[model samples]
Target: MSNPQEPYQPVQPAAWPAEPAGQPGNPGQHGAPPLPGNPPHGAPGQYGAPGQYSSDGPFGLPGQEPPVRNRRKPWTILGVVVGVLLLAAVGVLILVNVVNGATNHARGLADGFTKLVIAGDSSKAYDDYLDPALHEQLTKEEFIAGIKTLKMDRTCKPAYNQVNASTENGTKAADVAGLITCDGDKKIDLAYRFEGTDELRMINIKLKPQA
Candidate 1:
C-alpha cells in the first residue's frame, strides 16, 4: 500500500556570475584613471607632500608665495628727509639776507651821523637822527662842544668801515670803525643801536678811540 502525503524537495542556492578582468566591477585592477585633483601613480611628487616644494616658494603650495612688504617705505622716508633739509636751507638763506640788509642800513646811518658830527652840524644831527630820550638829556650846545673836543680837522673828509652787527632782545646793534684823513688818520670805533621792524630807529651812539 502507498503513502498519501507528497515528498518535499530541497531548495538550491542561486549562483552569481564572476566580474570580467579590467572592467568597472573588477576588484584587482588598479591602473584606472585617478580621480579629480588626485595625483597619478608613480608621479614625481604629490602636492603638500613631505620633502617637496612648489614653484612659487619652499614650504608653500603651488601658486602661493610669501607676502611682499611695502618696498616704497624707505624711498618715502628719504624723500621726506630731503624735503625738510631743503626747507631748512632756504630758511637759513632768508635769515642771512635779512640780517645783512639790517646791517647795511645800520652802517649807512653810522656813516651819515659821523659826517654830521665832523661837519659841526650838531643841531641837525640832534634833531634828525638822535634818539628822543638822548636828545632830552643832552643840549645841542653840549653835543657840539663834546664833538669839538675830538680836535678833528674840519677840512678833511671821514671814511667809515662796517665791523660787525648783532641782534639782542629784538634790537639790532652794529659796530662801525671810521678813519679821519686829517689829524694823522685818527681811527674811531662807533657802536650804533637800532630798534623797530623794517623801519629802524637810531637809539644810541657810542664812540671810542681804537687802542
Candidate 2:
C-alpha cells in the first residue's frame, strides 16, 4: 500500500505552496519541488542568480516590472521657484525701461523751457504750450517786456518736479512744476497745454510768495 502521508502533487503552477527545507532530490520537504533551475525561496541571494538581477536593482532586464521610483518633490519645487524669479526680473527690467523713457522726455521739456526763460524769451517758451486762441491775443513783445522790467535775472535755473500730463474735454495739458528763484525762494507752477509734439502752450501759471 502507498504511504498514508504522501505529498499532494501540484496540478498547476498556482497549486504549489512554499516548499519546506532540507530534502534530497527535492531540496524541499512537504510541497512540490522547485521548478527546474529556479531558486529556493528565502535562500541567500537565491532570488537573483548569476547574470540575473532583482526588480529592485537599477538597470534590471526588460519584461521585469519596474520597482516604484521615489519622486524628488523638493527639486521640482525649486525649479518652479527659479523660473518665477527669472520672469519677475524680466518684468522689472521692462518697467524700469518705460519709466526711464518717460523721465528723459520730461527732463528734455523742462530743460528747453529753462533755456528759454534764461534768455529773457519767456514769451516763446510760453508759446510752446499756448492754445491757438491765446496765441492770437498774446503778443511776443508784451511777454518779453513784463519779465524783463520785473528784473527777472537768469541767476538760478528752475527746479522742475512733480511733472504730469492730463486731459480735459478736448484739451490736453502738461503740468510743469519748478521753483522760479527770481529774487528769493519762490515756487512757480505752470500747466502747459499740449498743442503738438514739443509744443507746450501755457494754459495756466501760478506764482507763489510774490517777491
Candidate 2: the clashing residue pairs are 128-200, 128-201, 129-200, 129-201, 129-202, 130-201, 130-202
Strongest candidate by lDDT: 1
Q: How many backbone clashes does candidate 2 have?
A: 7
Give the alpha carbon lDDT tens digit for every residue of 97-209 in model 1.
Answer: 98888678777777777788778786787777776677778777887787777766576465665456777786666666655555665655556665554455567666656
Task: Looking at model 2, report the run of 10 residues with the lowest lDDT sum.
Answer: 188-197
lDDT of 2 at 38: 68
Cα lDDT, model 2, residue 108: 68
* Tens-digit per-residue lDDT, 74-177, candidate 2: 78999999999999999999987866665556556766866686677787776774456665676667656655654556665567766766445754446566
lDDT for every model?
Answer: 0.68, 0.60
Q: Estimate each model's TM-score.
A: 0.62, 0.54
